[model samples]
Target: MGRARFAFGVLAFGYAFLYLPIAMVIVYSFNESRLVTVWSGFSFKWWQALFANEAMLQAAWLSLRIAFASATTAAVIGLAAGYALVRARRFPGRTLFGSLVVAPMVMPEVVMGISMLLLFVGSERLMGGPDRGFLTIAVAHITFSIAFVAIVVQARLTDFDRSLEEAAMDLGATPWVTFRTITLPLLLPAVGSGWLLAFTLSLDDLILTQFVAGAQSQTLPMRVYSSVRLGVDPQINVLATIVVSVAACALMLSGWLTRKKV
Candidate 1:
């Protein structure tokens, strides 16, 4: 009984430690004072200001667009790569290809960002095209996001039963038909999880976007960083609160869906 009680106490403490800062951010978001440290009174003025800021709104929209585009592209490419790795046997350079697929996940974001920027600039110079902008940012985001999607899909594929796919193929089904009918259905959960992971990564990214984004394409995090450089504003807190709330809802929904599947 004592050991059980001690374990429970430790878990409770861990949860509090994780959530306390988030609680503080949500509470201070309502502060009426310009100074975040002192609580003058509670008000919705910060939320109102956040909604009224046109530049911030535009940045938010652009961020959403980039996140969706990058996530979709990443999901498609990652699904193909994951399928190849899991299903193929005795392929050429299989080990090297697998390492390349996962390398971006472990690589430092700063190095990845700088390398992507240089590559885009070099391409533009050689091709005699317009300089980097939204397209560069989207492509950079896809590069990192694909690694996340591949990781998730690979985890699911590791436990998958290969004989089921073989059974479908032996029963007079073509390779494409077997894959579409049998493999794809079993892989749906992994695909959904991968897409969500990719989307979240794209949305929350700051470093890579900062390196690749052009003058006209500022993401929400970029705008927030610039604003915070001036000083902490209550509106920034309000924006953070909104993002936290949305993220929480998404996690809850994912949990509920998983539970339903089980």
Candidate 2:
């Protein structure tokens, strides 16, 4: 009883510590005052201002496009890689390939960003290709996002019953048909989770995007960074509030889906 109570107390304290600043930010987003510290009264002017900011709006749109494309590509590639890694037996270099697939997850983001930038620059120089901009950023996002998707899918595959797949094959179904009918249905939840995870990561990324994005390819985080560096504004708070709300909704939907599946 004492240990359980102690664990609960620690968890509560940790949660409060992590969320207190977020709660404060959300509350103060409604403040009417220009100053972030002083709370005059509640107003919706900041929220309106956020919508009115043309640069921010453009950046948000670009970010949405990059996130959607990168996540979709990552989900497809990761699904295939994860399925192979988890199901294939006695294949050559399987161990090395699995490690390579997961390398991005453990690697430092700055190192990955710099490496990707160098790779793109070298490619451009050699091939005399067009400049790297949105395409480069999307590719970088997809590269890292695949690692996340693979991890999620691999977790789901760990507990899966392989015998079901074997049963499908034994019933005279072709390998492709067995995989399509039996394995894919069981992996749908993982696929959805991976897609959402990839999208969220791409949307939130700043370091890698900073390295890869061109002058005209500003993402929402890059825009926010520039704005906050100049000075703190009420519009930033409002933007933060909107982002948090959206993230919360996504998390809630993921949680509900997970529960339903269970």
lDDT of 1 by residue, 1-262 (tens): 9999999999999999999988888899999988888999999989899999999999999889988998899989999888888778669899998889999998999999999888888888899645666788889988887877777677778887889889988898999998899887877777777887788888888999998886778998899999999998888999989999899887876566444532
Q: Distance from true position, residue 4, model 2, in Å?
A: 5.5
The residue-by-residue lDDT of candidate 2 on 190-213, one tens digit each, is 888889989999999999999888
Model 1 global lDDT (CA atoms, 0 to 1):
0.86
Mark the regions of model 1 whose C-alpha exceeds 4 Å error after superposition: 257-262
- Write down the lDDT of every candidate, Cα atoms only: 0.86, 0.89
Instruction: Report the lDDT of model 1 for residue 178.
Output: 88
Screening candidate 2 with a backbone cut-off below 3 angstroms (N, C-alpha, C), the clashing residue pairs are: none
lDDT at residue 38 of model 2 (Cα atoms): 93
